[model samples]
Target: NDWHTAIIPNWLKTIYAEDPFFQKTATVYTIHNLAYQGIFGWRILEIAGIDEYGFLYPEIAELANVVDLMARGILFADVITTVSERYAQEILTPEYGEKLDPILRDRKDRLFGILNGIDTEELNPATDPYLAANFDVSSLDRRVENKLDLQRKANMPPNPDVPLLGMISRLTDQKGFDLVGQVIDPLLRLFDVQFVLLGTGDPHYHAMFRRVAEEYPDKTGIFLTFNAELAQKIYGGSDMFLMPSRFEPCGLGQMIAMRYGSVPVVRETGGLADTVKDFDPRTGEGNGFTFKQYDPWAFFGAIIRAVETWKHRDVWRKLQIRGMTQDFSWDRSARKYIEVYFKALEFRAAETVGGSRP
Candidate 1:
């Protein structure tokens, strides 16, 4: 139905509109992105025949916008969460607040931010079928085999000497697809790097990358559709992952890349900032290279830094090995959510005289 997109806001309104069900059951709403909040009109709600005193008002109906719905959801939801703790706080600010600052502040105590986890078993470099040679956590030799295989598979010349910079994401303005397009020609010419990208998003980006690929056939490969297996191969075979998100709530690709033993070269924003620590060669402490500035040059400069490190085979190998070993699993994250759930339950029970855990 056309109203399915409006279901969330409608349901939230319905739950609290002199109804006993919301009072009966505890709900914790997870706001993954405030920007794309599902906004539908009161007309749809009226068509659905769900008019109530609180929900029938004109202002209430117009609150169907994404940001307002988030605020409304925060008001009614027993608890809420975002992907990371930093983002949880970021959403409460005026700059990063997304116009829900006051609402988020009102519900601050009940809100939680747990870093999302990736399915590591599926992403393990050792057992991935997409790679040419599937090895385990212990053997890094098979990694090289997969790398060479990916080169042959993508039809790019097997130049192990060149840094294979791979990216898999929705080619969008916020994703720094604009930045990539801005500096792509210069970056390709300047660095000994081969670009392999697999994604589909903005049509202009798809066309742009395709044109770039046609112009620099030997240097770039663009796959416009998202293939799960191809993404795995890209992660397994590529030397580094590229993500220069302008404002990321939390990203799964960088985590997936780390699991595949691919170092991330990303802009320091949102989850990328939290996950990919800046590389300090002397200490060898960070997982990948990161830059804070959002400009294309800053992103490309980080790539050059990665390339420099890649030239030193031993150092680069250590970075890849450490990334593969880093745990980005769902287990820890699930536990945190479980804690949040129980906390919500406790609060819910406290609000009801007869309510108690079964």
Candidate 2:
């Protein structure tokens, strides 16, 4: 049901509000993605036999026709949170808020952003069961074995000299797939690099990538769907990962790629802006490359920078190892969630004279 789809575990609001037993337990709602928040009109309320004849004047309730459920969740919950510190800020902006700006403004003091973490043991390239070879941050030379295996499986020409650019994401406007699909031919013509795209998305984007693979069989490979094992292989094998989202709340793929020695070349937006630091040649402090502009050329420019740095084999190897060594674990995120739960409990305690929990 669209209602339920819009409201995952949102029913707790009414339940916890009414039942003191449930209220004793605090709830910390994590907003992984906000764009798909549950939204509907007066009809839904009316269908449920809830009267809409009153309290419809506020600008937000006026759109009772389409109130983002997440927006309402923010106002209703004792505390709210998102995936990254930068994304936590981005959500307050009108452009990114998607009509939830006013509500977010009201609850600004209560919202906390926690950066997500990955399971190192499950994702390590050396221990991963999916990869063709086992290698660590130090023995990265062995990564090429997995790369060759990937190239052979995909029918791409085996060329260790050429950089392999990888992308594994749902093909969508949000992912900036529109730009990649439109400009892939030009990019292939311009560089000797190989692009390997894996994921299913809009039919047009899928067709476009298939066309690209057909046009340049040796340089372009498209897998139109994702498999967990295959994703691990690409992460451990590919030389570079590409993420050009229009707005990403927080991305897990780029982090995983770095853990597997794949340097990321991403657009600076949302969590991408927060996680991937633009590479610096002199200091060599940053992990990967980034571009601020959304234009196709800006994306190309970032790729060019990555290519220029790749020429320095030792430096590039160091960059990969540095990225693979980063930590983004769920435990850190879980602790932050626990903190929000405590805040919620405090709010619930304050509202109830009996001091019931939230």
Candidate whose lDDT is highest: 2
lDDT of each: 0.77, 0.78
User: Which residue pairs show collisions in model 2?
Assistant: 25-358, 26-358, 40-65, 41-65, 117-328, 117-329, 118-328, 118-329
Candidate 2 structure lDDT: 0.78
Residues 1-358 of candidate 1 have per-residue lDDT tens digits of: 1122334534644545346766545667787776765455446445546554344323223343222344556665567788888778888888777666767776799888888898887777777777787866578766777677777777889877778989999989989998899889998877678999999999999889989989888888788998988898898889899999888888999998888778899988778877889899889888899998889889888888998999898888788778878778999899999998898777766755554321
Best by TM-score: 2
Please give the distance, in angstroms, between residue 50's alpha carbon in candidate 1 and its true position after superposition: 4.6
**Number of clashing residue pairs in every model?**
1, 8
Deviation of model 1 at 175, angstroms: 1.3
TM-score of 1: 0.88
